[model samples]
Target chain A: MTGESLHLESVAGLVRGLAERRFSSEAVTRHFLDRIARLDARLNSIVTVTAETALDQAREADGRIARGQPRPLEGVPLLHKDIFCTQGVRTACGSRMLDNFVSPYDATVVSRLRAAGAVMLGKANMDEFAMGSSNETSFYGPVRNPWDTERVPGGSSGGSAAAVAARLTPAATGTDTGGSIRQPAALCGITGLKPTYGRVSRWGMIAFASSLDQAGPMAVSAEDCAHLLRAMAGFDERDSTSMNRPVPDYVAALEAPVDGLRVGLPREWFGEGLDAGVAEVVESAVAVLRELGAEVREVSLPHVGLSVPAYYVVAPAEASSNLARYDGVRFGYRCKDPRDLHDLYVRSRSEGFGAEVKRRILIGTYALSAGYYDAYYRKAQQIRRLIREDFLRAFETVDVLAGPTSPTPAFRIGERTRDPVSMYLSDVNTIAANLAGLPALSMPAGFTAGLPVGLQLVGRDFDEGRLLGVAHRFQQATDWHRRVPPGFE
Target chain B: MSLSDEQVSAIAELARLSVPRDALRGLAQELSAILDFVAQMNAVDTSGVEPMAHPQDVPQRLRPDEVTETIDRARYQAVAPAVSHGLYLVPRVIE
Candidate 1:
């Protein structure tokens, strides 16, 4: 196969290509690495390109194929978001604190993918410590949107989204605390899924918010995401919160018909704050689902408006506690000199964390502090229950909720950096799903003013198969997912 | 609801993070804005609502009292900034 065709192939296509011996794993891996070398400078999507290690893994996969011992993902090259700990490789998590900290072990997601024979093509950049809405917070640099270089790629999975959108890699792993995976996938015109809170093990993935974080796949199509999710999700004893349920074959579930499916459009999602262009695109996508014999209706989720505010409080409160481990003690960064442990702790953290991270830590500390805990932290948790209840009420009547994934398409870089509240609102539509711990995904709907728009589908907890099946059917009806970025082609 | 610079300093101290004197003013303004934004939650009455911590209501799973694996102290400490005699080195506390 030509290099152009090689880069354009989906994860499933690449798997088949390797199995059929149409292209060797080494050739495929080399093709992607070469693309990153030539194109990534424009996007700043990758933090590290593990060329040597990837070639080694690809060669091993080829040997296995030669011996008729092929594995599930056998030789498919993919990038992991820097948040996942890659054994013996620098897993920076887009922060200066861990820039020098090479992980001693692989994250559960990483280990599972490796077990499935997927080749790692280095780590993708992200918002520092997975905190920001745009990729601008990365200690490395911002990951630019492939569609327009001046615009931002929604983050903290921005790098993974950009990499997959540009075809630099066939697939990449992304973790969503509050819309990290789906928001970026929306802005960058790719497919991303955030499984139910406990669906994927978070044993080695760095904690942003313990209750909210989930790792999922970002790829060009839902079919590809299904193939990757089958390899990535399952119960693990290490993560106490990991759900003990049988892993469903997501790929096989994609064949289920969307006929007679119930899709609800939350009235709150279509109200103010949703860009008109994005709403129109989402409505058109819903029309396609309706034509496929699915039932569509407007559902009320009144409490969802408070999701952003509640999320801001709850996530930061958890983050402050989780990040306290970064003091100048064990691993990570340390200050040059210190008068005492107090100075060491303060100075090391002040120096290591970025502005956005520090702001969150302060907010979290104040919220969880002695006198204000009930007003902020506890109040947010109560509001969280209300938000979850709203979704539960909606799900009682509908199998899935469909809407616009992001409020707008990719905004210009530095657009909302000065106003932190504005930045927080970018996640308004997607945060409720995380709060509810439901399965949700974003797929390319169409383009608006030369930029791509995404249609989001959310489902009841552990109903990822239904969400993927719905998205797969949509992609079949439209060519939006197949549309590559301008210069990327 | 706006936080003063002094309050910001107190919160920073509580979090064990040092903020430069110049950055404190701007930081205080940002924090105050965020607080005002989140204060919108107070408008609704959550009189009997239980605070949800975990998304799923699952009881903590207890494991048998057995060592899962041997400790690799050296391998774990390899990433530490300072280590001496198999222990992590820190500023002298008692001194």
Candidate 2:
């Protein structure tokens, strides 16, 4: 392969090419930064560009190659969701409150990615404090879909999705809490995966609902996601919730055959709200799986419809607690006036957060408050268990489950922003996976009325290997994942 | 089913959010719509059900007692709004 071939290559392919000396890491890094320069202006997908530091790291990677050191992602260029902390870099979680906050230490995931030799291409924008489903809540500005600038790239990982769809970076890291990763990938028409909750370390990623928050990857293909997940995952003693199981060779699983795999289509996922066009494309993707020698059956996760409400209560109650640290005392934005200690606390917070974040804080406070805890927050937790049990019962019969990643494809910018509930509904189709703590992957299935749709593949906890194999076989049978957004070049 | 202005203000205080009074009505309206949507949860009869705080059945993991990590306050507090003699400074609470 030529050095130019490294430009749009997947993580696995780029690593292969660079390790073979077909292209220097410097040339490849320069190519991607140049692509970002060319394609990112109109998309507004990147929040900050780390070109200077990325090149410095690429130079170090080249020296490692000279030393004959070996690692899987030695020369790959990657972007990060702004939510993850990077020492010395402004790690804004898309909130005005943290706009000036620079982290003191590298997040565990960032350190691992660096150890694997992936160059930092800077941070992608997300919803402020990961509170909103749409990137509209971001302090920077909403990210435009590279496909049609008029439409939103699904968020709160919208920037990461847009960059990959436009090939700004080969792959990037994203955090999912209530569908942030998969929804944005579906809207932008790319591939993304959210591993089982404990599979990836959360030591450095900013907290949302700690129970639902997880970090994974967005890329052009399932093969690339597998490689990125391999580097992003492992047991970290620092994160108390991190699972201490043995990490598998996720990329190797992609090459496995899909023979005899049992896939279940939950009856609940195809109900009243699914867009007709999206349903049609999803059915066609199911047909392709049957053709690939996989067994397909109808299954029911009875509590599926309850995921959104459960997520709303659980996530906010946690957020209401987590965001208390940013009271303008430690770092970032602060108020100019302080009549007393109480005034300082109130004014600093009041001035720092925007409408959407404050709204969630209120909602969370209500749910967990003295009178309503039993009625609202407590009840939501009970339903959450039933939701998990529904998956457990289904998984007993099927190896994997499939659903449409969203009710519809990406909508126009400002289409659902005015109605906050509608924006929250965008995640309705994807949140069950998070609530169940299951591994889920979304890949481009087809298009509807010119917009792309994603077919989500979800499996039992720690079943990322099975999910990747299923996605890889489908990719081999179709070319949808290779389809880029219009005008990306 | 909808949150009121007073409710919004009270909730804000509990959550440590400092919403300006002018923003309360709008906040109440927006949060009302979302709460109304989530109110669907109340319709289901979960009387005898147990509330689940986690997805897994596993117990919480414990770490061995050791001095594994520490932060340098002098360096960390370099960015504080106010710090003095290795302590963070704040507006006086008591007269």
Candidate 3:
């Protein structure tokens, strides 16, 4: 098969191609590595391109296939968002603090995928420490949207989304603390799943918010996502919070009919702050779901608006605690000559962390500080429970909730940088899922003004199979997910 | 909701991040904007609601204390910015 042939193949397609000897895993891995080297500079989507490791892994996969003992993802190449610790690779987490920090161990997600025979093409760029919505916060630099180079790709999974959208890799792993996965997937016109919190292991996934962080798959279609999720999600003893529930056959459930499926349209999602174009696209996508025999109704999630505020409080509070481990004492960036531990801690952190990360750490410190913990942190936690309860009540009458994944399509980079709150609002529609600890997916719904829009479908906890099935059915009836970016093709 | 420069500096100090004199003013502005936004939570009467720690209320599982990990002190120290004889190096706390 030609190198271009690798672009159109799904995870399953690539696996089957390897099994059929249509192409060696080495060939497939090289094809993607070449694509990343050739195309990634234009998008700044890749931080590292591991050609040597990829080829070695691919060759191992080919040997396994030759022995008639193929693993599920044998020969499929993928990009991991730099947030996941890759054993020997520079898992920078898009921050200068860990710029030279080669991880000593693999994140569970990374090891699981490797065990399933997926080849790692290298790490994708992201918002520094998974803090931004626009991917512009990266210490390396912002990742440009594949559709329009001048525009931002939604982030902190922006690199993963753009890599998959541009077909640089067949699938990629992304972690969503808030909307990092789904928002980027929406903006980049790809499929991304943020499995129910605890559905995937957090061990070795650098934490931004312990309660909200979840690793999931970003791919071209829900079917591709399902295949990847099957390998990525499961119980891990390493992550104490990792759910022990049996992993469902997500791939087999992809073709399940959506007939009689209840899709609740949150009234709050369609209100003000939603771009008219995105809303129209989402409306038509809902129509397609309706056409496919799913019932749609407007449901009220009264506390949905509070998700942003509550998330700001909760995520930063957790971030402050999680990031404390990065002081000059252990690993990561350190300061020059220090007078004492005080100077070492302060200078190392202030100099090493980017502006956005510092802002969050400060916010978190303030929120969790002695006098303000109850008014800010505790209040936010109560609000989180309310948000979760709102979703539970909504789910009583609907199997999934549907909305526009982001308020708008990819905005121009630097548009919201002046106002951090504006940047925070980009996640308005996507944060509730994290707050509720529910499985949610964003898929290409349609394009607006030549840019792609995404429809977000959220499901009950551990109900990722049902969500994937719904999205797969939508992809079957619509060509949105198949549409490639202009020059990417 | 507004954070004074002194307050911003205090927060930065607590977070162990050195705030440059000029950056402090800007940090104060940004922090105030964020705090004011989240202050909307104060309006809601969470009178009886318990502050949630974990999303799922499941208690953390405990296992019999056993050695599950082998120490790779050298490998772990490789990434450290400064390390000494089987220990992480840090600025001297005592003269």
**DockQ per candidate:** 0.85, 0.73, 0.81
Quality of candidate 1's docking, in CAPRI categories?
high
True contacts kept of 3: 0.87
Tens-place lDDT per residue, model 2, A406-473, is: 99988888888788888888998899999888889899999998888999999999999888889999
**Roughly what TM-score does model 3 have, to 2 decimal places?**
0.99
**Best by the lDDT measure:** 1
Model 2 chain A worst lDDT window (10 residues): A1-10
Candidate 1 lDDT tens digits, B1-95: 89999999999999999889998899999999999999999888998999987777776777889999997999999999999999989889995
- Model 3 pairs whose backbones collide: none
In model 1, where do residues sit more than 4 Å from their true spots?
none
lDDT of each: 0.94, 0.86, 0.91
List RMSD in Å for every model shown.
0.8, 1.4, 1.0
Model 2: residues with Cα > 4 Å off, grouped in runs: A1-5
lDDT of 3 by residue, A95-204 (tens): 99999899999999999999999999999999999999999999999999999999999999999999999999999999998899999999999999999888999999
The complex in candidate 1 yields a DockQ of 0.85
For model 1, state the Cα shift of residue B11 in Å. Answer: 0.7
**Candidate number with greatest DockQ:** 1
For candidate 2, the share of real interface contacts preserved is 0.75
Per-candidate TM equals 0.99, 0.97, 0.99
